[model samples]
Target: MVANNTGPKIQQEKATVSVMIYLYCHQNHHTPRNQLCNECHDLLNYAMARLTMCRFGEHKTTCERCPKHCYRKDYKQKIKQVMRYAGPRMIIHHPIMAFRHIYKNLLSK
Candidate 1:
């Protein structure tokens, strides 16, 4: 996986994405803990691939702030839906990651 060659930042971003997707799947699809429905699983894989091939690599900003858009329009909308549902809940379900993401965004600005 490209994650093996990436820096800590990229790995952490991957973890955050994973958590978001998990939360989304769990709530929306009524998935079991630590499991994803088929559609969500596909989305997670797609998101990971996009992140792996990210042009900015370790120095990349959050997808929302990036100058270039890498995701296809449909997948982009799907991810946006996932993020919208999962973002606020991160503070409750995964506080540390949520705060770290917020902190990283603040520093990037």
Candidate 2:
């Protein structure tokens, strides 16, 4: 039998179960709320951690300056677009129509 070693990122993802637990206990229970809560919480935590760890420069991007947290070389075009627009747009804005953008993106792909 082989043991599968999880990376730090995977551990962080597992840590995000807290958010799912939180949202679940909120009492607005929906059928898919479990998945939503886990994924949403994980993303919130990941995004927050990414922001907190950034070494952002005036000229350089969070992705460029802190590639570990922000860069996705495999999704080059998507990362570039997100870095250029979504990165800055998300700073002051709450997640209002962000769901629409995400739906369009994921549904299309």
Candidate 3:
């Protein structure tokens, strides 16, 4: 089988989502550090699957900026909540990734 070589942007997107979900789960669900609750785990898996199959592939924009809405309604809402809660905290918890994401957004505009 051939390997699917996703670019750095896709990798970063996965990492960003993972971090966001972890932060949300840790704070709101009281999940253990570096661990995810079942609900969050399921959401993360679903999100990753959606990302992997993204029509834009490596050229994909951030979900917020993307023209397409790939997620199911409930999962989309859950992820939005996670992002809303975790976005600000990202600067404190993971500054490099946070700033990179911000920089990318600026460049994309």
Candidate 4:
């Protein structure tokens, strides 16, 4: 994929996943450093991989509204849990990205 097409989506996914990890880890698990535990890290990597392989690339819709669900069953559930937990928190913690994400979803519909 072209960098132009992939860059923003990749960055958005990174930010979203980062927020999810922060919330999920702080509440449920203890880590030595400000880093995700192995499970969350794996989930993040899986999310990134899915973003990279997205068929729509630059023109992609939000994954939630996408017609094709690319994630496997377990990973899909995990990601949904993350997004459900982090989506509202993002407005408080990362307002700009959260607004952009919400706007994008609105436009996609």
TM-scores of the candidates are 0.93, 0.27, 0.92, 0.83
Best by TM-score: 1
- Backbone clashes in model 2: 0
- 1-109 in candidate 4: lDDT tens per residue? 4433357766676666677667776656776546788898898788877777777777778887899998999999998887887788888877887898899889889
- Expressed as tens digits, the lDDT of each residue in 1-109 for candidate 3 is 3334377878889999999999999999998999999999999999888887777878787888888898999999999999999999999999999999888777667
Model 1 lDDT per residue over 1-109, tens place: 3333267888899999999999999999999989999999999999988888887888888887888998999999999999999999999999999999988888777
**How does candidate 4 fare on TM-score?**
0.83
Q: List where candidate 3 sits over 4 angstroms from the true fold.
A: 1-5
lDDT of each: 0.90, 0.39, 0.89, 0.78
Question: Model 3 TM-score?
Answer: 0.92
Tens digits of per-residue lDDT for model 2 on 1-109? 3223244433332333233233433333353533444443544455445434444322222234334445344444433433455433432452433343344345433
Shift of residue 73 alpha carbon in model 2, Å: 6.9
Superior candidate under TM-score, 1 versus 2 = 1
Best by lDDT: 1
